[model samples]
Target: MKILICLSNVPDTTTKAKFVNDNTAFDTTGVQWIINPWDELALTRAIELKTDAANTIENITVITVGGKDAEPTMRKALAIGADDAVRIDVEPKDAYFVAAQIAEYLKSNPFDLIFSGIESADYNGSAVGGMVAEFLNAPSVSAVSGLNIEGGQVKITRDIDGGQEEVSVEMPAVLTVQKGIAKEPMIAAMRGIMMARKKPLNVVAPVEVEALTEIVNFEMPQPKPACKMIEPENVKELVDLLQNEAKVI
Candidate 1:
């Protein structure tokens, strides 16, 4: 089985986000980038799955849509245990463009299983995995929290309204993994890091796809208001606040 995992390089969660180009583009100045947390989970889980299957999986290839600036993150994914990497040479415009680039890359090189995060941390669009499945005309499972492979079939558990649902499907399917699908991401060991330098990092030109959306502006949310304390005996006041001031009631 050949497995393909989609990854993204994103600003660390601790980084202070800023926008440039009249607030229409993210500013990368002085920002530290890392493999997106959700994508890391997907990669780690794919590694675990491959290992546990007694070498049923032949290779685990990680792919991304970005320029050379994103190569560091790709190497990090390789260090985490992917067999190889593919970097589509292009500026990642949006979720649609990214997914289209990946789908286009997969046209000639298909895999038995495809893994991606439900959404990227920076955009939180939650759209790419499903869009890639649509572009490839393949069955897709989203928000997957549990995965198991038996024989040639794949079973997945996902979150649903008020509960969870389990589904099984054949090979050549796409999955959008969620956080709990795997344990905390493993730190890349020194040996793995060294081995990653020798691993293949193939670069390919992106296939043509017109962008469907554009960012008009970016704005940070307003600072939250300070909390107000109410005395225990002021029940009526608390009720009034809930009914009028907070308006939650």
Candidate 2:
């Protein structure tokens, strides 16, 4: 069995976000980028699945849609344990375009399982996995927190309203993993980093796909107001504020 894991590079959460191109595109200047934290869960889980009994997974290939600027994150994924990597040479415009590129590639190179994060850290658009599944005509499970494989079938568990829901499905399926799918991400050891330099990182040309949405402009959220302090004796005033101004009740 072969596994395809989608990887995404995003700005580190500490970085201050800025927009360029007339406030239509995110600026990359002096920004630190890392593999999306959610994607790390998918990668580590894929690695664990590949090493389980029966050894069903022959390869865990990580793929991403971006230019050379994203190669560092791909390399980091390789260091974490992906067998190989595929870099689709395109600037990721949106979720649809990126998923279309991945789905197009899957038509020629099929896999038994595909993994992606439930959402990206930057845009938080939880749309790629389902879109890829739709384009490939494959079954998909979203927001899965636990996974296992047995006898060529995958057993998945996810949280519902109050409890967990377990399901089983055959191969050739897509899964969008959420938190708890894997613990902390594996730190790339020096040996693994050295090995990653030798691992195969293939670059592929993107298939044609028109973007369905365009960013016209970006506006950051307004600054919040300062907290107010009320004396203990102002109980009646607090009630008035809650009823008329704050309006919670």
lDDT of 2 by residue, 1-249 (tens): 899999999999798989988888889899998988888989998888777858678899999999999999999999989999999999998899999999999999999889999899888999999999999989998889998887777889976768889988766999999998898877888998999999999999998899998878998889999977789999888888899999997
For TM-score, the strongest prediction is: 1
lDDT value, candidate 1, whole model: 0.90
Model 2 scores worst on lDDT over the 10 consecutive residues at 48-57
Q: After superposing candidate 2, which stretches have Cα over 4 Å from the reference? A: 230-244
Put down candidate 1 lDDT per residue, 31-50, tens digits, no spaces. 99999898899888888888
TM-score of 2: 0.93
Deviation from native of the Cα of residue 179 in model 2, angstroms = 0.2
**Candidate 1: TM-score?**
0.93
- Clashing residue pairs, backbone N/CA/C < 3 A, model 1: none
